[model samples]
Target: MTSAQPSGEIFELQADPEVVDKAALEGQLPGSPLSMHRVAKGHFRVVVSGLRTDAMLRYRFRVHRKDLGRWIQVSDPFAWQLDASRQRWSTRAIGLEDATRKKARPLPRRPTFDQLVIYELCPREVVPKATRYADLVTAPTGAQPRFGSIFRAITRRIRSGYYDQLGVTALELMPILAQGWRRATPQGVGRPFESPTERPPWGYQAMSWYAVNGDYGTAAELVELIDAAHARGLAVLADVSLEHGYGGKENGLVTDLWPRWRVPRPKNRWGLLELDLAAPGAFPFVVGGLRRLLVDLGFDGLRLDWTEKVPPKTWKRVVAEVRRFAPEAILISENPTLPLITEAGFDGTWDFFFHWEAPLLLRRVYRNWDGLAKRLVSTQRKLVENLEGRAYPPHGAKRVAGIDPAKGPPVVRYLESHDLPRVARRRVRWQHGGGHLMDVDGDGKTPDWLNHGSQATSRLGATLLATLPGAILLFQGQEHGADDELIWAHDPLESRRDAKTFGHYQRLLKLRARLPVLRQNDLRVLLSDDKRHVLAYSRGEDPARGDDDRIVVVLNFAPQAVRRLRIPMPSPGRWRDLLGGKTYPCGKELTLHLPLAGSLLLQKLGKRQTLGKRQTLGKRQTLGKRQTRAKTKDCEPARYARHASKPVSTSR
Candidate 1:
């Protein structure tokens, strides 16, 4: 194994052509997957693409050390011995340093930087049909969400300055595996297979888990995408729905090949395609296929959707087998109910506590503040205990290294996801209450669902999601104020331009990624929730990093205002609003100029992993001439004089 050079830089991996040439002549390394290209006389480069990176900034490098007969894993993504003229290699922001001795090293598991923010976007849910590339919904026009067409589009996003641009470190994609899709039409879209007049592009109703959907791109395309992501410094995770499958729809597959495959055709409309993990051959076919797919493709982690539904015992075996294929694979289970799953083998379970349950409780329509707090307490206690396994602890919970009280797998927290009513839909549903689905008014203007429900909550939710500890998963457009509920319908691409939620989301993403405390798992408990009027909590290592240290978070959820906001902390310093760089008073109590209770982002005032890389940002492209002029006024003075201000004092 080889170590990457320096921390926080991007290094690439190239096949040693000299060695490859020798091997090619003698037949050691395979030609189909591995290739070498020439550089200068003395050195050759083999660029390995499709590696995942995080804010920690690590590169995956492979090398062959003569000392060790077998090939060795290198520290950096790209490596070369005695390449003195390599300026590019020396100037990257990677933490993994190059070896001076030119000896092979093993790749390490820990990230150089501790904070990693993985954004989740069910592509079809976020990007609307008929949405043109330019019709980005923001009135002022902001940055576009880094979305991809091919699997590589994701890599391009990681490298293209999207996540990097947005300040997000790692990236997570909803199932890229085979999801049957069709053009939105009146009949319906995807597996339900409706007329063009009846479809929506939401991919929840999937078809096959083994094959990568053609619309999203091919398997090779996916590989290229992952490799590109790694180069861009992103740690990638594949979200797999191990709980159920698309079995039993008009669902037709070659079951005989996988004799255990069960496609049940239930009588009910909402009937799911469930698998009996207890069944024979069923476990392997279910587990093996995905395990093989992930290892073959090489992803950084796995997000198991709804592991709660899967029997715990069965899930244990599945996880054990998955580790055999890729041990460094981060296991994240999206089970809202089973906080205990963290001990079963999962690195963490989705803290639906923060994502939905807690929020819903804060909303007051569902659960009360006490109810929410109790739920948190109940689950947290159960999770705190380590269930002894035959080998190690039962996958209940294990405190992470370097993070005290950070004992649980990360809680995947979110505001708006592919499921549920759009943020706006929820609001509208609460207030005026109308559509089962959003409908254009007779005047042709879109419904106010986005502005009221989806739009408002989205902005607020983003702020809160970023402030919460554990992990924050960004759904597409939530930052930009997505107005549409992620409901699937069969129609032409009509809704794309209507939703203008990308800019806010992009801002939110960068904020969340910059804060390390929000990424740490500890008790970010919400206090003083009188009938869900205000949502508040504390996150991070509180007693202090060496001793359970953390930052306190308090929110005034009342849509009106909160002149005084009180949060619990051992003591306080000036609390800074990480969102707009605003600072709030600290001590026993703090006051907040509350806009609404839906959401926000806050960090304790102190030195931490700073936000996005500091750069003289280029002029942000404005949408209209008026906005452009405003931007010019804002950016020109800084841009021109800074470059022009250099004095010609060369007389010395």
Candidate 2:
């Protein structure tokens, strides 16, 4: 790897390799020979990438930096840990007695938004299926999964910090409720389906929500996975279907002992029995099961699947119950269709429409730029307007429409997931019209649907997503420009062999993380049109202070036209195109001659501009004058009365 310092110059100096080989697992990354290589002259950071860890897995790495500067270790790895040795990182098992013995010391807190990149990885490139309780010994197509078992090989690159270069938060793992997929997994290994049973790939038709698919891991192993992730500053969110459950293959305790409480449903996709969310006498059975599975699972939150289908009363009760056992526990509904959950409820909701629909809308620039802009402005405006005076849905209903609180919690915005077909293979792109020439990879000259301008638009899409009024989300390889859409299957993020795609992600994420205004909720659409294939939007905290606290986002979907646009200059200094890392000077009126399919996130340094060069209120003078004014303003109240006719709100 060409070592480039943060300054974009060749890195100087060299450091010894940072190694972590403490992992132990059957067919795990068998220890590799420690090959010492001198970094090519001028290269600085040598990334020894891909370090893997699971629940309870212990990994040991030795570090010897040549200069010995304070090394800042950052990774969104498995939730493992640095042991008491500080140098030796490992996952420790907690026992009642052991925990009490170490009561004086607590485990480190998991990484949060500030330190990690979370991603919703797409699995469409891989086979689509729900998580199983047994081990994933084979792929959906029956090919042996090689790197899937090599955690260290895969994660080593991540630990080396290259993934950060690819935009991501934490990787969101879909449901691996492998209660019955064991027939594919070999015996004597972790068996989610030890004896064999019926199951469905999408785990939403739940059998036992409390039980972790044995295929995924045992309770102890899950602990290791969590600990490893924490060591990397990454946290995990699990797929939880609270609205319903499968009764066929149930929890050992629930099915065998409490079968009477569940209602059998033989006709659904899973054909397994399901719990009655609204039924009488079954509420405790359901709650008890969830409380046990979720409260103690050491998960960050539940991606409640098919949430709209659940009963709001039941959801509220479930949340209320989880809080009793674990106050910090969070639950987010899947594809909520109602008003987004906010303050005192769900943390956030996914923005499926933005990614799913934005691509088609942006594609309009291939024809009329003005018409496209108008269309965009209309669509966005309608949503912004429609949300007004609308009541938020009950927790259960919010699960379907995917809107979470638009005001409080950041809504989770995503373009793809397990249920949706890979965007690349989309059967039909709605009514807007995607031509046959779009099949770019089918041995043809024309662009394929997957790699069309839409392909490139997906990159710009991430910038838009991060700049939206919600929590940013990227389905695994989308950052890498992976051509595959999300299919219901195992192994999404780095599931396949393409590593180059993530290169774009690294830059996109750094832009989003470095810019604060993009994360703020103050939003305004400066331009929106579908025909011209251009959509311009602005985001900021306060327009008054927004001179520098603002960002101008422009997307040009046109493939040929060099669209010249009169754009707003957020500030008076230089406007830099964040995407290309290029700068352009501007004031008041800003013009852009964008390349075909080009998009821009322009940030201008705030000028210390004030009306007629008024003095920047010095700290002492500013506060002191205010104090003196309260006591010394002569006839302050009389002056106020004289201006009564001119009284006005200062917001102007």
Candidate 3:
């Protein structure tokens, strides 16, 4: 079978002879109906005598079904464009490259996965309610008002230079595939009902893999937005769903065209039909669509949704094929528990370890602070060990054979995502609720719940995220401490912007991008003060190189200030506080006052100053005298504890 060229008159599609008996193509113009001849078991082709290459040619395929004893109309599964209202295939038939290749300008340099600080946003939430157009007056009365599309809003953001200013290297957009044409209900038993609207169900219930969501914009508009991003030196990643499609057993594709293409949904969850990867001609179809997205649509990477639900072998095969075509593409899985991402040939996986445990640390749930710190360290170590194919004793899992560890950590640490409730609510119901909301103070009723303490905890979380050894992701509005509960098809933080919180994240992210030590995968615990609720650690690369590039992070988890707290110094000399822009002298330790949930990020200064013998002696005497007095003030009772004892050191 011959396929259409960049400007050809012939069109081709793939179908199994075992599934389809005969096929015909239909177009909108005169002399519409065209016959398709089967040249091979899985190849079907048709020729148009005088077809235009510039204008969109709306068309569909009519297939003869043996089981139903009737003909059925189906859209081309490989169509680059879709007529949303009609649910038909619409394309210029000018080859997929004409969409993005001519429009997307060259980027200065594409960032690697390790260098990427990803920002994930849902397209649905980005569309503005109403935008005023200067020239065209669409509304009858007042100023010209037009409802903006998702792509337009995002293009405006890119032109405004928000992402560049925010220091994010890549934009990870949520699924943009055709969705929201129908709803899945228990009564319908996987039957689809018409429910088209501006806002869809987060684009997870995808209708077509090859078509752009109509609500967002046309395929051309989407390409322009991506080109705008590339012009600004930013990479774009597409979040895709491969586990299942939107419709069920009653769907036309499942019942008529390709019955063997689907498998039973596991436990009938979500009433969605799963794709049978083992089916004949399935891999080529899936891989072709993915290639179109990456190569033709100009996407730099993919974030596969719900990857753990996909069979391990199927996932491996998909990764291998995608790598064969797009070797530099970044592939990250949504599976957080598994550390063998490199074994499956994935760049990274979601860091559920940090997502699950970091909040507990912020809440100060564990009384034994040192023990909790050790557990956190141990958990991170186990992740490394598992990636290196070492035996894990806690889970009784042996060494995974034939796995090679990558140079960088295979995790993407994030504090908030679309899957979980906001951080404020999570902290309020700190005890139980399975990361969901309960009847609590943080349920939007208590404004005080989002006060000073909450912001401090968020800043603390951001500090840990920046200093951690992996790629990082910040969900929409997360950089500014958005605390609204994640409701389906709703985004509360879209209209809210806190300059202070935004500035905080901007400073940290920019620092992380510039500092070599922050990007490296080396950490050493320097101090853990259980009584004062403080933890200090040093992060750097190559210890033998000394303290030039070493960074020290000291965190105070207490709700109240800790006065005259002395933290041990890794090296004795002068040190500079990168965050506060202050310099201090150190012998064996340094003393400072820490605010509520405050942190100090310090780096050793190369220039050292020596003090005279008498001056050093006098300083030591004064510090010793003040240490006794400071102890009484620091020995306050723990707020969350009853009958607390005097503060004491329990560092390891």
Top candidate by TM-score: 3
Indicate the TM-score of model 3: 0.79
Point to the candidate with the largest lDDT. 3
* lDDT for each residue of candidate 1 in 115-194, tens digit (9 for 90 to 100): 55666765433333442221112111112112124444444445666665665655667776543323322232234433
Local distance difference test values of all predictions, in order:
0.43, 0.42, 0.62
Cα lDDT tens digits, model 3, 175-291, are 987653455543334333333333346777665667666556667767888888998889999999875666533212422467677665444445555677778866677777788
What is the alpha-carbon RMSD of candidate 2 to the true structure?
A: 20.2
Error of 1 at 374 (Å): 14
Q: Candidate 2, which ten residues in sequence have the lowest lDDT sum?
A: 20-29
TM-score of 2: 0.60
Residue 57 of model 2, lDDT score: 28
Q: Comparing 2 and 3 by lDDT, which wins? A: 3
When summed lDDT is taken over every stretch of 10 residues in candidate 3, the lowest stretch is 634-643
lDDT for each residue of candidate 2 in 1-652, tens digit (9 for 90 to 100): 1122343311122221232211111111234322223444312332222333222323322222333333222110122121211111222222222211221111255433333345653222222233232233322211222212122222443455544446554656565442333221111112343221233344443344444443333344444454455455565666665535444331221332233445553334334455565554466655654554444545665667656655565566777877887565445666545432432256666654444445544444132111212322333333332222122342123433443344423456555444433333324332211122232122334442432434455555555556665466665556555554333234444444344335555666676677766666566666655445566777775556556756788876555554346655444445556767755544344555666556778765546422111111222222223232111111112111111233222110
